[model samples]
Structure formats: structure tokens, C-alpha cells
Target: MVINTGLANLNRYNLNFIIIFFYYAAIYGTIAVFEENMMIRSIKDIILLVISFITLFIIIFKKQQKDLFVLFVLFLFYIPIIIIPYMFLNLSEQSLLYGLKITILPIVMLFTGILLSNFIKKDKILNCFKGIFFIITATWLIQYFLGIEKLLNFGYEYGINVKHFYGYLRLPSTIGTPDGYAILLAFLSIIIERNIKNKKIKILFFIVSMVFILSSTIRSAIMYWLVAYITLFFLRVLTSRTKFIIYSSLLLIFVPIFLFIMSKVNNSLFSIHSLEDRLSHWNLIEFDPFSTKGIIGSGLGSVGASSVKLEEINRSLNGYAVDNQFLAIYYQIGILGIIIFLLIIFYILYVFFKKRSKGQLGIIIIIGTIVSCLFTNTLEIYPYNLYFWFYLGILIDEPELIETEY
Candidate 1:
């Protein structure tokens, strides 16, 4: 692929942005471990806001593509839906700003991805992610061997405690949580499956990923990865007869082992109480046509991990950490906002399906994320949320950029 100097520079700039996002959590974790000013972590949001404005500026002045325009419009329409809820709820100004920060930044990232897709080559994107995966995996391994005391020191500044499962410390690595680490590993697994041609190397990577994911002890992440890979296996990895044989062999050989392992993990692996608690919490948020909260929601930033800092708002709303992404949106934005969000998501999925040959990886990841969202607020999770929207933009349309063989 031949590239002009300007385009090459743009590509480098865009790639650097992605790298920054990929390591944002790790950098914060390192700083926290050394007892540096924890407020620096909040700088990430400021940087994101700046990037959003820059992207908006560029889209307005340079690239006015019809699709991009439509997306911008949809987001514009959804903004009011959320704002009205905040007014009705009488939330503080700080809460409103926080709401806008979380909601708008991800949408801006989608714009960034679409605009930069042509400049950044597909192979370069994969290679960048591959390097990131290896580096993060190394950190995870080191953290695993560091013992709980050392790991606890890593996030104590942020009030994040070390989590354990079945007497094993859930390794957060450079990421802030085991769930985040596992989710990142799961995403890397999809990329490896789609791009790596060497059978032995691919198998090795898969084994590493699986071991780390299991070590994290995040059932939702594990389930998301399994569902995504199983779908990929049938769609791309094997012919019909081969798929049947391989699947049958897998069940026969692995199911017993899996069951045995689960028995050992017991409550950690299968917690009925946790499941019931989640369901009960979900039930508590159900929409009521007669209620103001049901019609317009409690308002954006009314409840969520971000809202926890707003002690008065959190207490008034009786908000704990909302585990479900969809429910979190519903609690903040109301029914209309969620409907618009779902429509946008489905619209993106439709575009992905239309270009399935080129976008199958996107399809698998989106499906996996949606499933993960049911059990956890995947969208609120840093880096994952950023990359998720960015990739959706990258895969939404066919880029005319040079492509190398997968």
C-alpha cells in the first residue's frame, strides 16, 4: 500500500491514540501502586473530552460523510432524552456534567474510528493489538505470582480491593479489576483467531488466554469468550463434518474436566445466591408507567459507578454499583433513551452483517459484549468501552485503505 506523507502521519497519530487508551488503566494502576497522586486517574476523562471536541471539529470542517452525519444526529437526538430526565430528577450540576462526560465521549470515539479507518491499515491495527495483548498478559502473570498483599497495594489508592476465588487471587494485572482483565483477554482471543495463520502459535495463544481468563474467575467474561469463540468456530474454523467431529470430541474430552473443575471451585464458579441477588436488583428497577422515574428515568449520572462520588445523589437514588449495562442506561436515561441506544446498536450490527466477510470479528465481539452487558456494565468499563465503540465505527463501513492478506 502506498501512502502519502500526510496520511501516514495521520495514521501514526490515530494509532498512538489507540495505544494510549489500551494502556490507560495500566498506567493508572502503576501510579496507584507507587502512591502517586490518584487524581491523575481523572485526567483520562479530561483527555477524552478534549479528543471528542477535536473529533467533532474535524468532522464538521473536513469529512461530512452522510453516514457520519446521521450518527451525529442520532446522538444529538438522544442527548435531550437524557437531559430531560436530569431536570425532572433535580440532580446537581456536577452530576449532569458527569453524565454528559460518560455518555458523549464514547460516541465521539465512534467518529474517530470512522474518520481514521482509511488512514490506519487493518494489519497495523491487528499488530498493535497483538503487542498490547502480550505486554498485558505478561503483567497479569507477574501479578499472579506477586501474592495478594502485593496486589492489594496496587489499587488501594483507588479503593479497589484484591478479589479472590477458590483461594486463588484474581489477577487484575495492569487493569483495575479481574473482570476488566478477563474481558481484555477475551477480546484479544477474538483478534488472534481471526488474524493469526500459524496453527501452533494460535493454539498457544488460546491456551494462555484461557488459563488467564479462568484464573480471573469472572464467569461473565468466561461465558462471553466461550460464546464468541464457539460461534467463530462454526462460522470460520471448520467445515460442517469437521465441526461436528471437533465439537463432539471437545464435549466428550472437556466437559468432564470442566465439570470436575467447577466442582472444585463450587460456589465461586456457580453462585445461585449471587444470581438471585442480581435478578432481585434488576426487578427493583422495573419501569412503572405511572412513575416519573419510569417515564423519564432518574436522570443521567443519577446512578452508576461514576455517580458514587456524588454521595447525596447516590444515597437519594439508593444506587449501588449497577451490574447490568442496559439497566444502568434505563435507570439514567429512561425508556426512550434506551430504545434509541438499542436502535443505534442494532443498526451498527446490521451494517456489520451486511459486510460479514470483512466484519465477522466485529459481529462476534459485539454479540459477546451484549451478552456480557447483561451481567455487568461492560459499557462503563474503561478501555473496553472506548475500544468497543471505536471498533464498531471501524467495522461499520468498508474502508478503501490497503489491506494485506489475513
Candidate 2:
């Protein structure tokens, strides 16, 4: 019986490893040749499906009742938001397919996170992530010194695809794009700050990480880091003096640096043009608050990546990409959809805040995520959403669960 139990545990570990391996692959594996390839996208979908299936099996086999319950609750809550909008909006088949791909793909991450916490130690997870960050950051630096395109076929769109404004090359590292790299490091910085023990080492890491993030030229990432700093202060992790010093130092050093970079990138750091464009996008939303479509929404795929494809299928769609998450839901899902979305986010906040005593890193990560979402629909995008749900699982799970033997 002991041997049988050991075998089962080994099987569990093996399955968990596969899920995480593929999860990261799906996030960080960038091949420009496959950018618009349907086959490559399908393969990624298949991976997510397999991970979800294995996660469900393990949850059932192990009688992880709490996990099962949470999964059920999320599915139940999201059903109307996804379904009603699709139906009410009459989204095209292509659009529906595209929308669901982004919307549903990351559910696997939640399960993966749950299973990962159960099977692995936090320290082990941290070490593994550190290795990944190092590899990616090194690649990013290589791209900066020697162009990524010259080094390999895999090149950042900004660093290679588009003409660099002036000589600036916004290196994306392995995270696929400039914005993605910044967002990724934003979340990573939280984890690093929380896990590192030595103050001087932590400070060094912060300086290095911030440099990488700023070099990405993603203004939202800059905002995310600032918000994270303030959030950490509110959590009492940083003393008032430390906060003031860090803020002052970063502002003095990086503000002009970002301004100069943005100027060279053809976008000013304080570019009113960009802000106006964003506002114009928001103004395009025309839902009738009293109408059913307005109340429930157009549906999941009605507004984003899938929506663009939908325009090809139905000319009336003329899909627009609203970088803002709040507006995206308001346009696609309607008022009820936004309500449901807020409720879900609030629940995540509640869980993290409740468990903040033990999950301070998780709390900060979620806070950063919410802040980022305001600007870029982090919950709707790939990898970013995956990270959000993944961390949510980590935050909500009982501490005792992670302590249990695999």
C-alpha cells in the first residue's frame, strides 16, 4: 500500500510538471514565423485543453473539494457573461472562436496553479522562476547589444518588424512583445521583492529589474511599477523613508530617461495624442444601458482579438481594439458583464486581502494586476490573464494545502 501511494504521488508530480512546462511554453515561446499561423494557435489550444483535463482528473482523484467548488463557482458565474453576450450580440463564428480562445484558454492556469502549489514548495517555484527570468532577461540584453533578428529568426516586432523611432530598440526579451515584457517583469518584481531576504540584494534586484522594464518603453508598465510601489507602502512592507527615497530616486533617474526614449519612439511620455486616441476609443462605445444587449453585453469574443477577425466575417462589426479592460467589457459584455467582472475582481481582492498575512506577495501581485488591467485588460489578454488567474489560485488556496505531501 505504501509503494502504491508512492507511485500515485509520482504520477501526480509527473502530470503537474507537464502542465507547468507547457503553461510557460505557451506564455514565453515566441516564434515570429508562427505569429499568424492558425496551426500554431491550434496546437496551443490543444495544450491548454490537455492541461485542463489533467487538472480536472487530479482534482477529482485527490478529492480536492475546495478546488472543485471554486472551479464550479467560477464556471457558474461566468456562464451568463460569456453566453448571453455571444447570443445577444450575434457574434460571427470566427469571432466566437477567436474570443473563446483568449477568454477560456487561461482557465488551465488556475488549475495549474492549484496543482502546482499542492505538488511543489514555494521556494522551489521561486528558484525555477528565477532561472526563467534570468534566461529571458539575458536574451533581452543580447537583443539590445546585438539585435535579436541578427542573432536569431525570433525577433521582437518592435526591435525588428517596425522602424525604431530614432535608434531605440524596445527589446521584448522572450515575453514576445515590449508591452508583454514590461508587464511580465512587473509581476516578477513583486515576487522577487517578497521572496528575497537581504535588503541590499533586494534593492539591487529592484534597480536592475526597473532598468529592464523602463527600457521596454511601455508606459503602462511604468504605471504598474509605480502603483506597486505605493501598494507596498500601504502594506507597510516599505517604510515611509524608504518609499520616499525609492520614489525620488526612480523619478529623478528614469523620468527623463523614459521621456527621451519615448521622444525617440515618436511618442512622448506625456503625449496628449496617445491619451486622445484612447479617449476616442472609449467614446466609440455606444451600448444602450436599458437594452438587453446593453444590460448583458455583446459577448466574450465581441470586442478584442477575435472581434477583428469577426469584422472580416461581418462587415458591420468593424472591430476596434480598446486597450482598456473596463471599457472592453462594457462594450462587449455590457453593464451586467462589467458587474460580473468587477465582482470577480473584488472577490480576488477579498481573498488576497484576507490571506495577506501569509500571501503578501500574492496580494501585491494581484494589486499590480488590477492596476495593470485598468490600462490594458490584463484579464482579457493572454499570459497576463493566465498569470492573474494562476496567482489568484495561489492566493486563495489554504496554506495547509501547499504544505501537504505530493
Best TM-score goes to which candidate? Answer: 1
47 Cα displacement, candidate 2 (Å): 0.8
Q: Write the per-residue lDDT of candidate 1 for residues 189-234, one digit (tens) a residue.
A: 6766566677777778778778777777788888889888766556
How well does each candidate superpose onto the true structure, as a TM-score?
Answer: 0.86, 0.79
Off by over 4 Å in 2: 1-29, 34-37, 57-71, 147-167, 237-267, 308-317, 398-406
Model 2 is weakest, by summed lDDT over 10 consecutive residues, at 397-406
Count of clashing pairs, candidate 2: 4
Alpha-carbon lDDT of model 2 = 0.64
Q: Identify the runs in model 1 with alpha carbons over 4 angstroms from their true place.
A: 1-8, 33-39, 153-159, 234-267, 309-319, 399-406
Score candidate 2 by TM-score against the native.
0.79
**Model 1 residue 16 lDDT?**
79
